[model samples]
Target: MEKALVYINYPELIPLNDKSTEYDGYITIDDKFTYRIKLQVPNFPDVKNITYSGGRFHYIAIQEEDKLFKLAYYDIPKISSELLKEYASLNELFTTYCNCIEELQTYFDVMDSIDTVCWVIDPPKPKKSDYMRRIMIGHNVSIQITFDPLNILNLPQIQFMGSENGVAPFRESFINNLDNWDPEYDVVQNILRLIDLPFFPQEPTDAAKSNDLDFKVNECCICFCVQLENKLPDEICKNPNCEQCFHTDCLYQWLSAVGTSRQNFNLIQGECPNCKTCISCRIPNI
Candidate 1:
C-alpha cells in the first residue's frame, strides 16, 4: 500500500531495497535548489514511524537541532494510534523539512557576509541556529546584533556592550539614524550607516593585548570564569558605579538563592553581587 502511495504521490522517490521501507530522492525547492534526501518509513501510513536517515540536511549543523525537532513534533499534526494516516500528513512533514533547510541557507549566507566585514567576538564559529553575534565596533567596544533568520534584510535587534561612556555616542547615532537603514544594502553596510562609522575596528594583532582584552571582556563576576556552558557573561549590573558582569544563568541561580531577591514576572529583582546596588536579571524563557 505504501509502495503504491509513493508511486502515485512521489514518483521521484525510489525505493532503496525490496522491502520498500526506505526511499531516496532529490527534493527540489522553488525550482532553484535540489536537496538529496533519504526517508525511512518502517510502518506504512504511520506518521510516527517515519524518520530522517540522512546525516545532515544540506551540511548545515545547528546547535539547536533538538529544540527545533521538538517544536516540529508538537506543531505537526498527528494521527490516532489505532488509525492509519493519509498521504497528506507525509506531505506536510516534507514541507516543514524543506522550510527548515531554506531558513538555514539564508542564515548561513548572512553569517558569511557579516564575517567578511566584522570580527565576530562571541561564538567564534557560528552555527546555523546561532543568530546572535557580538562584533567589535571600536576600541574596547562591541555590539551584539540578533538577526531574524527568516527576514535576512530586516534591521536586527542591537545592544551595545562596553563602557557606558564609550558606547553612548554610538548608541545616539544609531537611534538618530534608524530611519536611514535600507534593506537594499547588506547587513554590514546598514550597520555602518546606522553607527555613522566608515568601518568596523580591526581586531588587535598583538597576542598579549588581545588576550588581556578577552579576559576583561568575558569574565563573569560570580563564577570568575571566562566561559561557562559555551557562553560568555552577558548579564550586567545596571548600576553605573558597579558595572559588574555575570552569566545570565549564573545570575539567575544566585538571585534565586538570595534572601533579598524577589521575582517579578520574568525579571528577578535583587542587589548586585559586587556593589549591593539594586539590579534585575531577566529570566530566559527557554
Candidate 2:
C-alpha cells in the first residue's frame, strides 16, 4: 500500500494558483499565511479563514472489495467520505488509510503522545507547504493530512458560509499564498532528524540534546509545549516504539531537511511506547 495523501479543491480552498511566489507545474503556489491559515484550519471553518481538518478523526468501510475511507471529527461529530468507491488508487488508499487516522488518534491517546490539538491536512502528495515530516515526529495527538478543501466545505459552519455567501466569500480567505509550507534549509534538517527518517542520514553537530530521553513525559510523548519553529514538529517521536525525543525549534539543526521520505513511518516494529514492553496506547486530547 502506498502511504500518500490527497489534495482537493473545496469551496473554502479556491484555485488561486495565480500570483504564485514559487512556480511548480500544476501546483499554484499559495503561500499566503499558509502558516496562520494552517493553524486556523483545526479550529474550524472561520469566516475569516479557510477551512481545514484536524484531530485523529477517520473511519473506514469496505464495499464490493473497495475500501471506503471516512473522516470523522469528534469536534463536529461528522463522519464524511466522498463516495470513496474503492481503495486502490494511491490517492484513495492514502486518503482511506486516513481511515486509520482515527486509529492514529487512538494510538496517540493510549500512548500519551502529542498533547496539543493537530490539524489533519490530507494532500495527494507532498506540496511546497506540505510537511508530513513534522506531523510524523510531534507526539500524542490526532493527525490527518489532506489538501481536499472540500472536507472543510462539509463542516457545519462552512456549509453555512456556502449557503449564505455562495462559498466564494470564504474561499482561501485566511490562507494567503505567503503562508505556503516552506522550510528553510536548516529547518528541514531538524524536521528530518526529529522524525528519525532514513531519507536523510546526516546527523546534527550536537545531536545529543535533540536526542534527549530523560525528561519526565507526564504529558503526551508526541506533545511539544512550545510552538513549532516552521509550524513543523521536531519534538516527540512519531513512531510508537521509539523512546527518543527531539526539539521543535531545532528543525534546521539536523541534516538536509529535504528528500528523506518513506512509505511507512513505523519505527518500533508496530510496538507501543515503553518499548521495553508493548503497551497499547491512545491520545488524550482527541
Candidate 3:
C-alpha cells in the first residue's frame, strides 16, 4: 500500500502566486493533486516480547522528516483498540498515536505538568536508555512522573511501574507520604488537581436536614456518592429546568457514551443523562 503522503513543497501547478502566504510546514495536496516526495518511516527498535491483556505499554519513538524527536510510553489499550478496530498498520498506528496525543495537548491544560504527564524508569533494555523521557528539577532532586492513560479501573492496575527502574516518585509519595492514601481515594484526583477541578465531593454531616440548608449540595445527581463533611460538585448543568449536577469526570464519561457529536476539548453535546435535556457540556474553564 502507498503510505499517506505529506506534501512538503508546493506543487508545480500551484505556482507561488503569493510568497507572503507560504507556510513553514508541509502543504497538503488535495485528493485531485499528486506529489513525488514521500516521507520514509524512521527505524524503531523492537519492543521486548511480553504478554499482557487488553494492550501493552510501549515506549514509542516520534520522528519527523526522518529526524528522531522524542520517546514516550503510554497505557494505550483504549487507543490501540481504536486502531485495531480501524485496521490500521504499524506505521499508521504510530502516526495516529502521535496525532492523538498532540490533539489532546490542545484540549487539556493538565498536559502541561511533566510530573503528571510521564514517569521515567530504567527498563529491561539498557542500550535504549540514553536520556530521561520527561522530567522536572526540584529540591535538588529531579522529580519525574510517567503519563498513564487513566482509562484503567483498579488502583494496582493503574499504578504503572517501570520495567527495570521500579515505580516513579509521585506514585511512591502517594503511597508512602500521604497518610490518607487509600484505595477508596479517587485515582484521577492528581490529574484533576492539575486541571484545577472546580468542585469536590461534598462531605455529608449528621444532625437533621433542618440543621443546615447547605446539606442538599452534597449529592451528585448521577452517582449519589455523598460523604460526611464538605465536598463540592465538579460542574452543574446550566439548564434552568434541570439544575442537575455531576462530577466533571463522571459527566464527561457519560457525555461520551450518549452524545452523538463532539466538540473541541473532548466535550460532547447531547441530551442530559438524567433529564434527557439536550445541552453542550464540558469541563469548567477554571
Candidate 4:
C-alpha cells in the first residue's frame, strides 16, 4: 500500500490551478513532502534614489515524496540535477545546499552564509487554518547581495516598489519564472564572480554618521538604549511612514510582560510601543 501524503490543512494555500470549488480544507499535494524557501533581500537601496537597483526575494515551494521543510534567505543563480540526485536524503541534500551557499558567500565580501532553519509544520486541527498561519518555526536572516562595480549614479532611475504588496499578474509571473531545481546549476558563486557588481559598498562617512545620529537620535523604543548602526533591531514596523525600531531582546521581554501572545508566522505580531504602528517580531539568532 502507498503511504498517505500529509496535507497542510490550509485552504488559502491551495494552488489556484486546482479545479475543486469546495476545497476539502486540506492542502493535499501529489507529492507527500514540500519545501518553502524564502529569500529576502533586506538592504537594497531605494529605487527612487540615484542608486536604481531592485533586489529580489523569492519564496519557492518544492514538492517531494516524503517530508515538508522550509528554508530561508538566499538568492540561487543556478542548480545542478546530478548532485541532487546523488544526495537523495535530507541530511546530505541540506549539506550540499549549504556547501553551495558557502561557496557563493566566499565570492563577495559582504554576503554572509547563515544556518538554514528546518522544521515540520504539523497539520492543523479541524477548522483551524487561521491558527496554523499564526505559528511559524524557523531561522530568519537578511539575505543580501552587493553590486560593488555597478555605477548607481550612471543608471537611469526606475520607479519600482516591491512584492510586499503583490498584485495578480506580476505575482503569478514571478512564481512561474523561477528556474527549475537542479543542485549543480544553482551555484551562484560562479555566476556572481563573472559579473561585476555595480558599486563597492563603503562604511558611512563621519558627516553621514553624524546626520543619522541627529535625525534618529539612535534610540531604541523598549530600553531607550542607543541603537548603533551595527547593532541588531528586533522589530521594525511595517508601516511605510513609521520609523520606530526596537531591540528584539528588549521587545520580547516587553511583549511577555504585556501578555500579548498573538502570533503570526512564528512572529510576535503586535503594535509598536513607540508609534502604535503594527510590527512583527522575528528574533534573529543573536
After superposition on all C-alphas, the RMSD of every candidate to the true structure, in Å, is 7.4, 22.2, 21.0, 21.4
How does each model score on lDDT? 0.66, 0.27, 0.36, 0.33
Alpha-carbon deviation at 276 in model 4, angstroms: 1.9
The better candidate by TM-score, 2 or 4, is: 4
Clash numbers, per candidate: 0, 52, 15, 22
Give TM per candidate.
0.63, 0.18, 0.25, 0.31
What 10-residue stretch in candidate 1 is worst by lDDT?
61-70
- Candidate 4 stretches greater than 4 Å from native: 1-197, 212-219, 226-231, 260-265, 283-286
Count: clashes, candidate 3: 15
**Model 1 TM-score?**
0.63
lDDT of candidate 4 over 32-115, digit per residue (tens): 322232211222210010110113222222223334322322234333442334323333444444444333332222221111
Candidate 4: C-alpha lDDT: 0.33
Of candidate 4, the 10-residue stretch with the lowest lDDT total is 45-54
For candidate 1, write residues 236-261 as lDDT tens digits: 77666767778888899888899989
RMSD of 1: 7.4
Off by over 4 Å in 2: 1-12, 16-94, 113-286
